[model samples]
Target chain A: MDKVTNEMLMAFVDGELDPAMRKEVEAALRTDPDLRARAAVFEATRQPIASVFDPILNQPLSLPQEGLRDGTEQNRSAVYSPGNPHSRTPGIISWFSGLFQPPKTLSVTVAFCAVFLGGLGLGFLLKAGLVTIDTPEAGLVAFRDDGLVAAGSLDHTLEKYKSGSSFVKTVSDGRELAVKPILTFRDHEGRICREYEITYPATSRYAGLACRTEDGDWNVLIQSPIKSRPTNGKDTVVASGRDADTVDAVVERIIKGDALGSDQEALLMNKGWRGQD
Target chain B: MTEDIRERVIAFIPRLRRFAFSLTGDWDRMEELVQDTCERALTRHEQWKPGTSLESWMCRIAQNIWKDGLKSKKHRAQVSDDSLHFLTGVDGPREIEGRLTLKAVMAAISLLPPDQRIVIALVCIDERTYAETAEILDIPIGTVMSRLARARQALYAGLYDSDTSSACAKAEG
Candidate 1:
């Protein structure tokens, strides 16, 4: 047989060689120290390289909420149910809605139809400029000059929903948006801040952290468009690149201690966030 | 059909993330690459033909996006430093030792030329066969073998030959 090259050794190590070639290499390895050492390099580097990135697979998949956009209520419900273990937990969404009925202190009812119509009305008003948006970005039209006030269904959800609860709002244009509060933590200034993710169906996603002010309004402290694809549908967005980093940096900066537990969040909600201050 | 494709793309995310990490060897860059890959795969999904390997197709998109970004950016020098921090941040002696070794492997992998690096990521890390890797990267089987061999040699030298630590000494012995 001709001299076994490094390429051939590598192929042999990878189990790509036929049985005849494999036996030839095995025979050479048994006799030739130099050839064995060369093959050893290929063998040594294989498993570590394969296993080094295994940790990433176990980490949470940070996907944009793309596939959940175009579905019906039943489809959306099924996507989050326990049967679909891959989907993010639906417990968080249903728990808050179940635990706290519409805020009795507030005038608005908790009915889905009423909230939908209210959100539709507010969406039209925002579009008509009757309500000014201090920062008008896609998936973030709810902000007002007084701070980042949640309008319509978002307003109701923010006022009543606990951390991890998610609700969908359909606007006048028939676009369905999913809003979910991800974390609840107190900031260094003793204000209760909630980090949230808003997904604009077929368009973009926005992540923001808003603090509840003394007046009981959730003021947007920071909001960034974390992901946006090109309208042409060809070019790709960097997904959760710098924008997500910026939001994370802000969260790391102002956040005090850990995020509130589900029980802690529930207690704070029951208190109407009053006596804690 | 688009909905099915989208679900399949979502399912392929964990593998794509692993492939992305192998390519970039930095957490932040790996994330960016994965996201970019997902967006491209989801948006231009029609370009992906059925009956082919979706995992390989997505990986191809990730490599292209990473290469395009590389063209505009400077070569990374901070990956090793970040890996060091990651290594030390963990607790438990056994876990720490494992992570330290893994981080060293990753740092070494990061230093390979991008071509060799991608080949390693696909063939070695992702466990794709030579022919499959050739198909994914659109390279000949001969090219894949050569790159894989050279990359493995470089990685072995970087991990063992460059140091006289007990681990290296044990491996060599």
Candidate 2:
């Protein structure tokens, strides 16, 4: 038999040959020591990997036990099974089927990251007059620099900057043209945290922030009024009459970083007006 | 036919896992990938289109599931190769079944492009004919030949580095 090409030899090794061709290759292999050796090494790999996986066929799958079987499931068997109430994944997440929750970001961390990046950036940017930030009575997210990090392969989480003692309130015009504020959060690093919804009044909208004032009123830590995108008269970023709290282009900003640890966060919430006062 | 297929596939689970383990050096992940594939196929059975070989079709889905699950953030990173890969320090050395050489070969196989990998896994590991592999992949037979050729060369080179010394050296020499 003439010398076979590498492709032919590979095909032969894989048994993709007719009986005549197989006989020819077998004949050649008897004379070719190197070819035989090459075949042996290639063929040997199948056995080891097969041996490695053999137990899996017999082993019943435990969602939690074999969950780490996939690197993508770093959290282990918790896809459908919540470990506990405090550890439950966010309800909004359930809406997105087939969407990989970033193995890295928790819902609260996601909430803060969303609020901080959007709140701070919009808060500070609108203050500087680069963009107009406004909000209805409901707080809006104000992120100028929502520093978001990829939590895992899929989830992009953001880090918020808030402290238990200080929720920076940027006052605009004597009337406080910004929207209302809500609770605050302090990250593990002791930075402040905030959240907001898209709020609108008349022609304008605000991504509100969760800062407060010395007075009992939840202050507008920061707010940005969106210059509404032109639509087909019927299209809307803000529904004409209803409250629309969807995230805008800054969806990436909204979920990042380690969310505030529980103890300090509760302290700020419980002390709310007292802390600012 | 579908009922029979369901029965046969359930029976083939052990066999399929063997094929999967061959592709991936680790057992745990291999099983996970296969289960994901089967689950996906069962739910999306309408797409299976009876009469075609279920094994080839399922094999395609298994590879896709494997591809979906197989991602190494470190491989694409621009970090200097001089430093240990972020995972290297964490996972220790690669998990080889017995010899480091065999493990190295499996990693090489994993690195095959999805196109070639599809063909190789279907044609080689599953022992399907070229026509069967082509049908499963929805490509032409000539494409199968070319990809298989490329896949073979890549495995050959990956299995043995010309200047290096390892378990593969026995085959290289």
Candidate 3:
């Protein structure tokens, strides 16, 4: 046998080789370390490549309208403008937004309360310009100057809160927001970063990540809206949407080790994030 | 017949999306490509014969869209190489490490040349056979085999081999 080539190994890995050639490659693989190692490359790369895009399958299909007759250029832009929610097809947006609507069977007082809360939430969302594509940093109202600095209530919350702890802070508008720290970990740079979720009662929810800088200031790296599906009486965290996936990808990129345990987080918090890298 | 084509096109959305994601390497662009592919497939339904593989025809439209520069060059260039820096990082537990490895693999695939990338997408990701991929891309089976081999080797080198310095050095040697 004239030594097996990499292409032959790939064909064998893909099961594209004929049985006779496959038998030869298998025999070689059993006896040859270098060939075995080369064969491992195809086997290893195949699994992740096949499964990497599996998440896209479960997402709602965002196809164009059934009878759209316009030019491809015109319809493509109108269907998906990335950050712009309004430009999205109304049917898809309505399907997602409908999940947030209040049920209609509540008492008059409860309905009034729901209306009031919904209005306040809408006001906050509008004031923050979160609905528009122009404001990519819509949820991080506490951070200024390109999210390098965390100030106001968010700064205080990040400094003191432990994982799984929740705090409510009333903004100047008298609307209270619930903030909870989801987890803590040291990033590759050895800086302590926290993943937290903020909920506007029944209105909206966002997940954010921030890391402490050298000067003790928390820098907001990314914040994204999360969808919470109401199951039974409790709200369960469902899909985190595309922006949330970006946050997770960034976390995967920077995280150094396992998320800090509660005891470790407490020790770090007590020492003001000092004496550790 | 037109209704049948429309139904088949809709059914192939997930497969098309996976292929588009591999080629575009970005979610937003993937959606755009899928939409455009769907649009083109329906509008030109006459070109598609009744009994052939509709998925292959749709994939061809997608490849042409991507190759004809419907996707901006600048956006393709923006698939960042940042994941490459973390390839040699210390591993965490199995689940976390598995996820990080997958992310790095995706980033590496994004960097492959368009020809090899599509070959990998069609064969590896979309699970297309050599003959089927050759027919869809209008390339020879030998070319597909070579490209798949090279692409997988590049990915393995870029990802797994980075963690084992001796293996990497030996592979280079």
Clashing pairs in 1: A148-A220
Q: For residues A1-277, what per-residue lDDT tens digits would candidate 2 score against the true structure?
A: 7777655665665567788997787767655767765554445333222222222222222123233223344444264331122223321112121222355643543343233223343353334443322222322332233322111100100122123221111112112121222234433332343544332333455443433333333333334554465467865544342223332323224434544455555444333223321
Q: Rate the local accuracy (lDDT) of all candidates.
A: 0.61, 0.43, 0.62
The better candidate by TM-score, 2 or 3, is 3
**Could you tell which candidate, 1 or 3, scores higher by TM-score?**
3
Tens-digit lDDT track of model 2 for B26-128 = 4445545566666766667788777777777788787666665556422211122222121121222333212223244456665666566556555555556
Q: State residue A245's C-alpha deviation in candidate 2, in Å.
A: 86
- Assess the local accuracy of residue B169 in candidate 2 as a C-alpha lDDT between 0 and 100: 36
- TM-score of chain A by itself in each prediction: 0.45, 0.23, 0.45
- Against the native complex, each candidate's DockQ, computed on alpha carbons, is 0.16, 0.07, 0.19
**lDDT, residue B17, model 2:** 62
Give interface RMSD, per candidate.
17.7, 21.8, 12.8
lDDT at B126 for candidate 3?
A: 85
lDDT of 3 by residue, B149-172 (tens): 877777666665545444334333
Which model, 1 or 3, shows the larger DockQ?
Answer: 3
The digit string of per-residue lDDT tens for model 1 on B19-86 reads 88777766556656776787777667788989998888998999998888888885542354443333
